[model samples]
Target: MMRIWPVFRRELVGYFATPLAYVFIVIFLFAMGASTFYLGNFYEGRTANLERFFLFHPWLYLFLMPALAMRLWAEEKKTGTIEILMTLPIPAWASVMGKFLAAWAFSGIALALTFPMWITVNILGEPDNGVILASYIGSFFMAGGYLAIGSCLSAATNNQVIAFVVSIVVCFLFTVSGLPLVLQVAQAVLPTPVVSAIASFSFLTRFEAIAEGVIDLRDVIYFASLILLWLGINVALLERARAG
Candidate 1:
């Protein structure tokens, strides 16, 4: 835990040391606002729920989170600093957890900056603040899920673009897994129970539960386990890369 902090601090500071982090934050803020008002029809809805605002999060993170995570290990490998990082006294798991937490914190910052949307909903009328809070929590976990997937892909290659593209594709599959059309296709080839289980793995399904203020233990566990699983894979892959 103590060791993780140094890596976390280093990586977090590294983000702002360049224009990449600033550019990402600016675009992310703009996109969230544009999506809330334009695509979300915030004014037309006339509702104070902020449901329209949170609705686009999974899709938004599909691209944005990958861009944030693509450089996690890709930049390290590209510059051949990965060896230096690995040879440090810290455990690989600590480094892995630290890097992931750094990216996740950065994502949380972007999400938190959208507080204006929340404030607008409050100003408009009465709203379920509980549901809004729950949605924010769910959105953070969803972003973690996206980042974990991107981290694994980034570790697999030294190309940030490849990491971004592949993360989008994989995240898209998880996003659509619970859709009616996708479920229908799965049902045709799989048993009823199998189809149900597969749909349970969908990020949208888990996120929607919390978005509605459910906060089920199962939903939280799914995302927590996902982050752990993929990040474990990330550490193992990095070790293999180091050995080679």
Candidate 2:
């Protein structure tokens, strides 16, 4: 943890040192507001809950997470700073975890900025704040999953654009794995157990389960495992890069 702190702090502070952080925050907040109020019809629903607001989180993170992750290692490699990073005394795993955690925290900040939606719902009517809080937790985990995937993909390539596009495509597959359309396709070529496994990996499914107010241990474990798996791969990719 001590070895990771400097890298984490450097990466996190680097975000606010530029306009990228502000731009991302503004875009994220606006997108959340528009999706919640206009696209989701929060007022027309007449429900006090933030179901509409939380519902859009996965889809929103689809684009936003990749955009954030594309720069993690891609920009470093492109600018040739990755060599400097590689020379640091920190272990590769610590660097990878530090960078991933920094990006995840940045995303959490953006997510937290949407608290007004929660405030608005409370002012309008009594709602299950517990369920809402659970949904927030689920959304944050889901974002971490996306960022982890993107982080690995970013490390795999020097082109940020390729990293962004590939990250989106991979994240899309994970997001839709539980849907009938994807499951149907998988079931055709695969056995029942395999199909079931594919469905279990769906970000939407796990998140929706938690959003329903049940923070099932399985759901938490699933997200944690997914993040760790991808981060492990991310470290391997960086190790390979250093070797080459």
Among the numbered candidates, top lDDT falls to: 2
The global C-alpha lDDT for each of the candidates, from Candidate 1 onward, is 0.92, 0.95
In candidate 1, stretches whose alpha carbon ends up further than 4 angstroms from where it belongs are none
Runs of candidate 2 with Cα error greater than 4 angstroms are none
Q: What is the C-alpha RMSD of each candidate to the true structure, in Å?
A: 1.0, 0.8
Give the candidate number with the greatest TM-score.
Answer: 2
For model 1, state the Cα shift of residue 87 in Å.
0.9
Candidate 2: the clashing residue pairs are: none
Worst ten in a row by lDDT for model 2: 235-244
Backbone clash tally for model 1? 0
Could you give candidate 1's per-residue lDDT for residues 1-244 as a string of tens digits? Answer: 7999999999999999999788998999899889988998889998889788888898899899999999999988899888888989999899989999999999998889989888888888999999999999999999999999998899999999999999999999988899889999999999999999889989988888899988999899999999999999999998898688
TM-score of 1: 0.97
Poorest 10 consecutive residues by lDDT, candidate 1: 46-55
